[model samples]
Target: MNAPAYENGRLALMLNEPRLPTIGRFWPEFAERSDKEGWQASRLLGALLEHELAERAKRRIERHRTESHLDPTKTLATFDFGMVPMVSKAHVTALATGESWLEKGATILLFGPLRAGKSHLGSAIGHALIDAGYRVLFTRTSELVQKLQAARQSLQLPSALAKLDRFDLIILDDLSYARKDQAETSVLFELIAERYERKSLLITANQPFSGWNDVFPDPGMTVAAIDGLVHHSTIFELYVESYRRRKASDKQSAPATITMEARQL
Candidate 1:
């Protein structure tokens, strides 16, 4: 018998031919069909495996807090840099491009008044470093003192400082916000000394080095801490009106308030 007109040869002939077993029972045709389905299934499984692996990597970063040791407390969601000077999207892009924000043991000082976006800038940088697979630690100046106090009582000060090195970026937010005693100021300096050449730091304060003594309590230690940080750091001073207060005023004067929902395109 002549083969089917569309036949390429034996394989096509089998798929196209009428047979005793019927079209559904054509073994060669079914075999080829099964193979194609299997190939597709294999591809689907491979893609699933890759996705799972990526998820696991993210989880590992979350778990270690030190493996790329990023802080879980990044304030990226709270910051909106509208009219604030110093940090910008361009700065973050450069960071993501692998530029070192903290270079060669330099300190970074972000000074401004309350609600001046100081913490926001530091938090944003921390998030950026995390995305770039670098470790970051975030804490307010007061929180850091509390941690040091606890570490001291437990005789874990050195160990705690050792763990601090696990992060590539260390942010001491809200420095000079609340006043502190002598011992606390000493502890703060020690932590900085520990991180000096070993890692990077981001210090945010309401006042500059000259006014640090007002918050630090101990003049000598405060001066030393300021020296340690400023000796090798860049300082960004924000001298604008508080965005927080401005928004509050706007909301109060508005006839109605509206909340917007984020939509996927």
Candidate 2:
């Protein structure tokens, strides 16, 4: 049946219902379906509200992801577990889901040499957490320190740290890339202290704990930083050959790479 038309062609107003106009405009199809299905008024309202809430939640997640600054290309689906034989697929899978450790504000430390896929693993986990509706931020350690240093100069360091606190997990990529000077390392320590036991952190480094002194000039500071990070952390030492090197080796072994002079015969 057609709705009775009023002077403005909006019979919803005749019921003196303000919410009905919004409902009709936003969910016209659902309104028509409810009418056709002869649904109970209370039930229809509940269903419409639930749908609106779900859509709102989806929008919020998308917005959070965009503000997270995570790399779009890195995801759990794209990470190759086969390439990294030392890593346990079951264990990484559990962590990637971001369910278990996120609640406890635990840290994930990825330590390995260059080209060992440490950054890739950290970004993958950060991406997964974003997909799971958790806020995440990815930034190079040196870059983050520079930003913090600037914030300190401008007398906004506390607010800068506060802004970072909004994220549930912060992926600090290439922690070893930062210089081990007093000016740089102090801000880094401040960040760790602020986030200690409060928010989760995922750090990727080409150096192990023993080599952290190379990243923190003071030995005492190095010990303190390592102590804070490892207290409730899941550490992964990816002791494997470089994936890029292995791929290059495989290409060299392939028949397709035969010399042109040999083919000329």
Query: Where does the lowest 10-residue lDDT sum fall in candidate 2?
Result: 14-23
The lDDT per prediction is 0.68, 0.82
Highest TM-score: give the candidate number. Answer: 2
lDDT of 1 by residue, 1-265 (tens): 9955433356446544643223323444544665677757565545545555666568666654554333445445555656575666565456543355454655677888988767666776677666666777777778888889789879999998897877777888887864777776667778888887668888888876788787777777777777777777777777678857876777786644433222321
Q: Which portions of model 2 miss their true places by more than 4 Å?
A: 1-26, 244-265
lDDT at 7, model 2: 52
What is the TM-score of each predicted model, taking all chains together?
0.68, 0.83
Q: Which segments of candidate 1 are over 4 A away from where they belong? A: 1-49, 61-78, 86-88, 96-98, 102-105, 250-265
Clashing pairs in 1: 65-69, 66-69, 68-135, 106-232, 107-232, 107-233
- Candidate 2 collision pairs: none
